[model samples]
Target chain A: MEKRTEPALSPLLLAMRGIVKTFGRSTAVDGIDLDVPERAFLTLLGPSGCGKTTVLRMIAGFETPDAGDMRLDNTPLADVPPERRPVNTVFQSYALFPHLTVNDNVAFSLKLRGGVVDIAARVRRALDAVHMADFGDRYPHQLSGGQQQRVAVARSIIAEPRLLLLDEPLSALDRKMRGHLQIELKALQRRLGIAFVYVTHDQEEAFALSDIVVVMNKGRIAQKADPQTIYSRPADSFVADFIGNSTLVEGRIRERHGDRATIATALGDVTAPAADGLAAGDAAMLVIRPELLSTRGEGVATFTGSVGNSVFQGERSMIEAEVAGVSLRFAAEAPLAAGTPVALWLDADRSFITRIAA
Target chain B: MTFRQRHLALPVAAAIVAGCLAPLAVLVAFSFYEVEDFELVPAFSFRAWGELAFSSTDWFLIGKAVLSGVATTVFTAILGYPVALALTRLAASGKGLAVIVLLTPLYTGEIVRIYAWRIVLGGEGLVNTLLQGVGLIDEPLKFLLFSPFTIALVLTYNNLPFMVLAIWVSAEMVDRRLIEAARDLGARPIDAFFRVIFPLTTPGLAAGSLTVFALSAGEMLTPSLLGGTSGSTAMALVDNLFGTAFDWPLASALALALLATLFLVASAMAGLLLRLKGARAVVGRV
Candidate 1:
């Protein structure tokens, strides 16, 4: 029951603390604490069933937290219903009111509140932002899938909510349309300066649109960081593997120095940057990106492998090889043909080592 | 052989449908013929039609009955919606049990249910005993039974299941996510129900209203039992034509007019409900 006019007092926009949602006997979102700073573009990124969408639902007040306190600014939102919350959601299904015109769909919130002033102007502006101004008269069935998605966005943004929760908004569109809308939505978010809490399993879309990417696994956060940090320096084995292409080699910590450590694996012994809580005899994964492994090198920490195949991707070539009967994948500029002898160079600086939890 | 099978099947199906309509068509045709010794004559005249059109008393009585039927239909809808809502809100297992209970009265003969109501609403019935025990009244209230109100109450109870079922079916078809979406759009729980839930279920409500209207219009059992002499319905008038007066032509005329009016009202109700349902689907698709 806080004052609605005091928007400045609660500038965080949305703060979800220790959110836990359980369906039947199983937990869908476990002990999640998330915050979206005012006007920040935050993406909840994960594979399917990782509870990213559940987190978005909790923020939008669609799902109640079993044990958590959500706040809009400094005000506790636990008791506030979804409709009363200053948050709007773009559902995965688009969920545009089928009976109303596109203009009516966008103006729905305004109509719900029984206010008539300037609805047309606001709806037009919202449609223009999404580059769908002329679609105001069209019914949803008449429009294409991409147009429906844009109309869904327009409907949400027309109300000017403090936080806009997008649940895989672009996933239903074609790839090219998805890419185009991603740029437009990003630009629109920046222009409006409204907080956008986007949820998606697509890593590329998350990386493209998010100021901060929250990677989730089994209803818990794997890592939360900027796109570059999450890509380059993932917190654990799961984060590293889930984010990008990496050669995860199982090994044991052989030695640890002040800032450097070396692990012994089936591939070879390689020195890597020191990770916290690393001890001798502890099982760890040496996460090395494909491009970090070179095709030809003779070094102290190098593996001699026969390249089985090379995939000629436009930017880089992916070489799959066997080193000591262990399959290792690496990327290089030059394509190596099948059954070719190759020496793979391992770079310690680019490789992140983390203790694997059993 | 296939053509022969089609020919046989189609004719037989058409005969079955025609068999259903033959009784009403015979009544319409009989309205133009004069009755002699309980047998209809082959010759036709405009005399019965003229009598039906000019008889102001019959028109007044039929109009009153129609007005009462409409009122009872509305009453049934109002009473049925809450029960349907409560039923829909129940757990799946509970819903199954509830549906069984709601349909129990429908399975038993209408005579049995009317008698059961008579026991409940009678002079020395459950209601009288309860009122006497509570000392709310010194005597059993005669107003409770044998009145238009009694007939309306009976008609509503008789038609309650159809209304409830119609509303429940529509209510269940509503996408739950839409309610959540409305809430996410800053609608209060009450607002969400009014804007999303109720509007979406309107087709069901309209359907229920139409069902109750049709059932109440053709109701004979309840009016004959509970409506007494003063609160007679259109069906009671038709029954009297065939019974006490033996006025076959007048009864046929009244039956035809009643059937036509019921058809028009039912069609109008269905058309309006369909338009609303279509509008809901259109809005929901996006």
Candidate 2:
């Protein structure tokens, strides 16, 4: 029922109010409101089947909302077809037309306009933007997945739409390729100054590319904030759990003062910055980020526990320590053996205490 | 030795050579042999060739066969595209039902279908009767049956299934996202069809054209029975020469000529369709 939107800083490019979409009996998008500022990089981030993509589809005019009002540049988008809308999408699959060469694929919209005198020059520039100008003659099948993805971006951007929608554009690429394209896409968004609404389940991708991140769950937005705020001060347990390698300990608030609360958990009572409106005896969760826990600290140890599991990652190891029947996960530079006695210190001042999501 | 797929094709290839090429070789020999008094002979001569080469009537009939095949192919393709694309849009279960519905007419014997068509298109048949009842016509339309129209209509109806099925299979293989991408890139529905859907399905169209062309070109019974004055086909003449007339040499020459012309036309049709960028993009990669 609450509309969660930041005050418009730049000119608003797109605004959706109370948008809802359903397929047969199951609802894909619950009533939700969203806003995109001009030249903003906004990301709809969630797990699969979280209605992020449905929202993107609604914006691209691929899926009509069942009950909602959507406007772009102060014009209602209800009657505009996808082709007529000044919007384009970079599909998740990169859906490059197989029959056309890369040059023709990028020139598709211009050709449809009939007698665009500078189509070839514009196509060259679009392809050059994606570093794919040399592949003008290549067919879609002739190119690799990443190359196809680049061509897809070139095609969508060639028309210079007012808004661009991307549905997990980098998901199909290898990890290294995904990282490369993420940097490229963010740079492209900045250079073009076109508003971008990107949908992805990868938290790191969302954080890396977006100025505003919308976390969705069960066809509704769980949280909408800047990525740093979302990471350090998650609105609820769901946002905290979904974002990073964090341990959520079930607890109840014992006292609240100003912006801090002391929550009683199985381990012990700890004071931390908490979400607003948390009174005593209210159910809450202590979000222990991996960075907040250390084996060596200046103060006295918070808990004495034994290392339960340590997975050796390339640069660091993810270590889980068992204390009071709770598996507390944290990262360590070196792998620790199981059953090794470890004394862990909790930086409760920086940890977040937030309400449990319904 | 390890067996491969090409090796498996050996026996089928042998059977075809034995069943098809050997008979063609025999026809080549028979075309040169002179027939005397309806008696068996093996003497080679140019008499049959000379007669066929000079007969304008035979040439006209052969030209008519080519035109008929091309017309039927074009008609079926024009009508089949929408049905095939519609079939692709159906749900999986609905598609199964649609396929059965499309092919249900084919389940009836061709002769039965021809008679059913006669009942629908004849002077006193369903269409004419309905038209008369509606006062659209003063007399039954004579062109309804026992005309070239009847033959073409019947041929298109009979061959529509094959064309639709071929295109439906191809259309089903096309990723739906491409069409969405086209629309997102500012292509209208009609533009998407011409620029994306139509080009991508050319391989299917080529296949369907070849099949319909072959089926309608060499057909004899349909034209002979349903095509009254316009019913004289090269096939019928060949049949007459081989059976009632007993001019085996001339019959062999005419049949071989018809086969050559049809083969050339089919090849050209296939070549033109397959040469499209869309077809090459699909088939070349595969």
CA lDDT, every prediction?
A: 0.82, 0.93
How far residue A214's Cα lies from its native spot in candidate 1, in Å, is 1.1
Report the TM-score measured on chain A for model 1: 0.92
DockQ (C-alpha based) per candidate is: 0.47, 0.74
Docking level of model 1: acceptable
- Pairs with steric clashes in candidate 2: none
Give candidate 2's error at residue A189 in angstroms.
Answer: 0.7
TM-score, model 2 to reference: 0.97
Question: Model 2, range B147-254, lDDT digits (tens) per residue?
Answer: 999889888988999999999889988999999999999999999999999999999999999999999988888888888899899999998999999888899999
List runs of model 2 lying over 4 Å from the truth. A1-9, B1-3
lDDT of 1 at B255: 77
Give me the candidate number with maximum DockQ: 2
How many angstroms is residue B43 displaced in model 2 relative to the true structure, after the best TM-score fit? 0.9
* Residue A62, model 2, lDDT: 91
